[model samples]
Target chain A: MTTTIPATTTAAAVPVGAGLSMFDPVFIGIDEFGQPVYLDVVYHNLLAAGEPGGGKSGLVNNICGHGVLCDNTRLVLFDAKLVELGPWRDLADAFVGPDIDYGIDTLRRLLVVATNRYTWLLANRRRKLGPDDGMTVILTVIDELAMYSTVLGSKAQQEEFSTLLRGLVSLGRACGMPVVAATQRPSWDIIPASLRDLFGYRAAFRCTSLNSSNIILGQGWAEQGYTASDIAPTNQGAAYLLAEGGMPRRIKAAYLTDTDIYNIADYAAWTRTPTRTTGLPDMGLAA
Target chain B: MSKSSPRRRFGGKSTGTVTVIEARVHRSSARNAKVAFVLTAIIVGGLAAVVATSYLHPIVALLLGGLIGVTTGAFVWLLVRVWPVIRLLWWWSTEILLAVVLLTGWVQLANHTSTLVTLVVVAVLVGVPAGIPKLRRLVIAWSWCLIVRHRLRVCFAQFIIASQSGSLPLILWATPTPVGERVWVYLRPGLSAKDLEGRLDKIAVTCHASTVLIERASEGNAAYVRFDIKRREVLNARVNSPLVDVIDPSAPASASPLTVPTALDLPDVEVPTVTLPTQAKPAGKKSAPTTTANGSKPAASSADADDDVSDWI
Candidate 1:
């Protein structure tokens, strides 16, 4: 059942190259019942569903690592879980996380900035600038979007973040920003309806509840009669990519060690900027 | 056998490519307006300070206005008459910060005509050009060396392009095909950790993958591939249900062979062409008892004879 696919861009009616799409590689796979699936052709963002210690990080790492392999795609990781994506910093252009509050706040702000950048780019005409005008694909890979949503405290914060995430997912295709939201606890409360459709490419690892699987991959995938683990020899990083027509591709998870990420940091030494630890340092430092 | 070896396996996920529009015009226009406003404000403030300071200290007033006027004139010259140079210089200039600093210094020097004013004015002059884009980049590099705690690197997205420009090697060792859909797995070497880092580096440089993948392969060369498909738009075709079956790494090889299962339903999914990033150098290493974080034994490897259909997971 292993099928090798060639890369070709058929449709060009609307411009697709101005944004991060130009910088990143798009992944195509198959669903369980032999059908085709695309990663970011028309923007079917990632949906990761698994339980605690259910290989969530391992799976996200594999996908993010593979997804960003395309030279053009840029990974901006928000690892609120601290250790999950922290190791893969080398593979990412910019990484922020472990600071739950700051991370969530930054995600919100980044969405705004990225959206502005995208809209600004779209308004530009070839009469003014060269061909390089396009949105830089910003993959905001959040380790625990569910927890972040819950920690927002008030309903408004949750709704706002949810709405912002939805905006990101809805307008992401045109703007070149895609949200790869991963969570061990998959639930309807965590993932809003706006983003539900956006997560067309759903990947379910080992889940604790059928409800979680149902919320993620529609139905029958997490039922009692059949076990996906039974059919194949699943490893830690491996999971099924669920899409409408995607043919189920049982691919091995990619492994990235800390040393490998360190190598990337070494190369990126030239571009690293000093992080402002003490912002403005109060009026005392200013004086 | 790796679950990928079955006759019905396809690609992994979708390509999240966005249609980006050129925003250079909007950006430049806004930048021009902002720069003009800032410059005007700085000039006006500087002139006012000079006029106001004349009552207190004429020497300080003259120097302050001259300095602010010169900087404004220079910025305007570069931004208007020679925009290309300014555009290029933006990569290395102090830019917005310098202007703001100069305006602030002008105000401070006006209010305080003491030695502090002279020092502040001097600092402004030096900080402007010195804090330019080039200096900014240099400072960034320096800080990275000194202050940056963790590693920072370029992600994989900067390299891969989804265009049909040239026929690069597309190496897909374990791609699954649907019943009627034709699929091709593009292969290049060096996609595994056991592969040579040098070869992987070379291919990554050549292919420009955003992030390279290193999967524990049973047997294969080290080359990364971009999983893409060329779809022939099929209407009303019932899409297949998502795979809910979990993979059991501990399962015996006899349980699942490298052949297509009879009970599985096949959907007519569009097949796309695939491309690989670059090849990696296969490092010499005996099959060590590799344990996953889950403490599971590593999957067995496939011989070169069975490389095509044998799942390398």
Candidate 2:
């Protein structure tokens, strides 16, 4: 489902808003009053900041589980911490962890592939192809984007990631693709100004510092003093949503189980052809 | 745990059962490959013969015949020296593309065909090889088995899970309604066992499954139980028991502790625990099972196994 960006309301529909496919089990919402609530929404990008035990990682899982239900979306996870997203390797399109010497290299490779695809699409004006174009929606999920940006090491790679992310955000919508980069630390260093602007949907679970809240939800959200600990009580999956043309709205993220992720993975994998199905008369080997 | 039990008499049998099914599938796939190989050969050979008679002069025919003989001889030698992949590919090329090669080879062999008798001879030459019984039966069997086996394994895996879990009553497996390349199992979670069973029945009213497995883990609990139900050979088992082990908390130092006093993080309920007997004792002095008098028992041991046997008709 498309993300709704209302023009000028005091509250924006939560980042994970209603009418989204039921990807997660638990969701956080808000009542007419500013109290927290629980409900589910679209498996979009999420950013969670809060004191420890504020359920930052839990929010990450909730978003992932929701995205797992969207068969059209492919999940390529970059989990810097390894522990948070390791158990989910089997269910993702690809995952990067601490063991890999060149995790940044892997990310670069993915970016190259994405760029090449986008280039091809643009050259061919692929938008005209409609359903026949046979494109799969890709979700480049970075669990701790700030940490990864540091691990990337090379200045060129960091800049490249930043540019690639912005390009993906700007161009991904029409292609039914999006980037989901999350970080528990809501500091400006982790959520850079450029990258923050690209994320149309923002969620701050609960912040240890008001600066992080400002970084994620803008000044108004920071004023609310939303805490991660307030998650369940405020609303089970409740988090603030900031988007283009809309005021912040609190919505809950949904909970999903392993089976849900598996089902979607299986479906997504099957929907794509072998990449080299109909043999050509020339018998060109597939790349 | 010691792997010795009197009922281990059935241990060897279980392995054999698994092997038998595995072997059957293996044999079926091989048979299919063999048949396809033969049919492809006959078709290719027949076309080659037709081309040779119609297009090759005496000199060309002799050269072509010599070439074929050399290739055959080389293949026979390669079979003993190389792996199956090389052998199979060579065989497939010889079988399916032989005709095309022969047609192309006419230019190399010498091209001359003017008489009706010559054309008729070519037709007969090709026709006889095409009708060869050895090749035709092999091809048919291989093709049929190849298709059937691929679909069979997929169906079997699903069946095994459904029958084993006894959750078939709550779940249904159906072919894609629109006939896409993908198959899906629609899951309706949060239903009562009966409601789930009703949903399963409604879905299954139009479909059938052979095996089912159900695994459930509570939200706050670390332990999970699984039930396996089988439909084909009659094996249905469930691990209705819970086993728990010590779970060391791993929270980041920067984050709040799990047992935080603030934020009202109290869980309404705690997972029940079971303690295992620590050491063996004298046959007469079976250690008195210690029971916690006031508090929940110490953390349950992490891993446990439940095994069941069934003889389903």
Candidate 3:
């Protein structure tokens, strides 16, 4: 039987308020009622997981497009699957993909930025990063995270990646650098428990199985009627989002076609300004 | 032996080892004498001043001299004993001054604005953004950081007092982590992380946190105690485990695999034939023959015959 859940206001229906800063509520997607569902990513990193063809990329694109459009936000794209993110190459502050070693290097570079930002924040005695701060908000997008992890040839390389990503995940929020990673598989083998636990905001589209759905969300979530497994294959962009302290809300991500992506990329590229990049010399190898 | 004896005889001069020792002793005695002389001179000078001031009463002069001498001596001893502590306090004077100024300002502001207005202002400032969960967490985390920065020493003092440990734990620093805030505290001599763990709940309660975790600090006699300032519910939500089984049995089973039976059983009984209805044909149309030229009833009822037969056929 199809479970009947109480309908929620969707993202599109929610009236956009005046004087809302970029650091304020971030628009995620539309809820069941077609009202816009806005979430604050200021202090919470996001994780999006779903089966292949389940609109994970669409949801990520929606969020990333919003982020890129924000005045003081910068995008870092790590596209392990090269096809999905190739169109937005010009928009991103740093784009890494198509090669495992290059992806690792990009991550290392971002790690350095995270560390430096942390030190700067600590020195300035500021906890939250806002438009008031001279630096821009950094939003790192890692597409096909499972593939990225798998490409790490050695255990040590994986561990290093995990540690750096952990630092960014754990401490990046305070520095205004939040990571939003999408994965086809939400298994512990793909996304380690340590890294998985750091994601405070989780969204799951149509998952392959109940196990995958639960892994993306949390234990007893499926039981609580927040089952992503029940999402029909035809409803590709539909997902269940669990904010930091909020209940699961079923929302349908606004679909962005190839043309829409090109437009966003064009806009972002036109408006983009060069920001400071980490000057640390490359580590030469994946290790 | 004979050569050594001859050399000894030739060298009439003494070794002078005893004279050198005597000279060292004399030098030490002279230094002591100089210190004693300086002390005596100061005392004599003070006494002389007292005597000069108390020309009218001899008894009063003696009493004043004794009191002054004792007071001076005690003051010097105390200063020598706690010079390091005094230096540290002096170095921290700016922080203390800032704290006092802030407290004074707050008190004045509270008096002027009244409690209600102050609360309203604070609520508007902190509570508005706190409506967002992430912002709420950020605020809580930042407040924790403030606590660690300013009031951690006071909290540690209270913990020490409550524990009746008779000594203070040397606090290095308290830093906020992803899970919670980590406090580096040097356990006093003869203490361990276990000792702190025993009183951690009390500390956590005082700090308005859910719990405390004590681990050995990376380097030194310090222990890292993480104060989980976030509500227990929030922490649980952040790091929850995945559901193992489906809760709603009546819900649609989308995750179930599609299955197909490999074999089927058929009955042995023969069936009776039914008459087919004839359709109207146009005057000029002719009907096609159903039987094949070489067929023995077209191998009727065979699996291949059924495969070839369409609904139209």
Top candidate on TM-score is 3
Q: Tens-digit lDDT track for model 3 on B1-313? A: 1232334466665443322122333454445445554565469647755776657476666666666666665555455444434644653555678699878877887889979998887677667887888888777776576565334455555554423323445555555555456666655665565555566556667666654545554444354433333223211111111110112112211111112222222332222321111111222323333565675455444423232232225
Ranked candidates (TM-score, high to low) = 3, 1, 2
lDDT of 1 by residue, A175-206 (tens): 55667778765566776756676776777665
Residue-level lDDT tens digits of model 2 in B172-224:
22222111111223223333322223233222222233323222323343222
Cα shift from native, residue B98, model 1 (Å): 87
The alpha-carbon RMSD values of the candidates against the true structure, listed in the order shown, are 32.7, 30.9, 24.9
Better of 2 and 3 by TM-score: 3
Question: Which CAPRI quality tier does the interface of model 1 achieve?
Answer: incorrect
Every model's DockQ: 0.02, 0.02, 0.04
Q: Model 3, B72: alpha-carbon shift in Å?
A: 91
Error of 3 at A225 (Å): 1.8
Candidate 1: Cα lDDT at B179: 15
A12-104 per-residue lDDT for model 3 (tens digits): 222111223448676655664446677777668889999888888877776676675566677778775555875665556677654455656
For model 1, what TM-score is found for chain B? 0.18
Model 1: per-residue lDDT, tens digit, B1-313?
1232334346544344321311343355456656775676577657856686957587777667666766675566455544534543442244456678878977777777877768777887669757797766555444332211111111121233222221223332223222111212333332223332223343333333221223323235334323222112111122221111112222211110112223233343221211111111122322343664589764545222122112212
Query: Per-residue lDDT for B297 in model 3?
Result: 51
Model 3, residue B180: C-alpha shift (Å): 41
Could you estimate the TM-score for every candidate?
A: 0.37, 0.35, 0.43
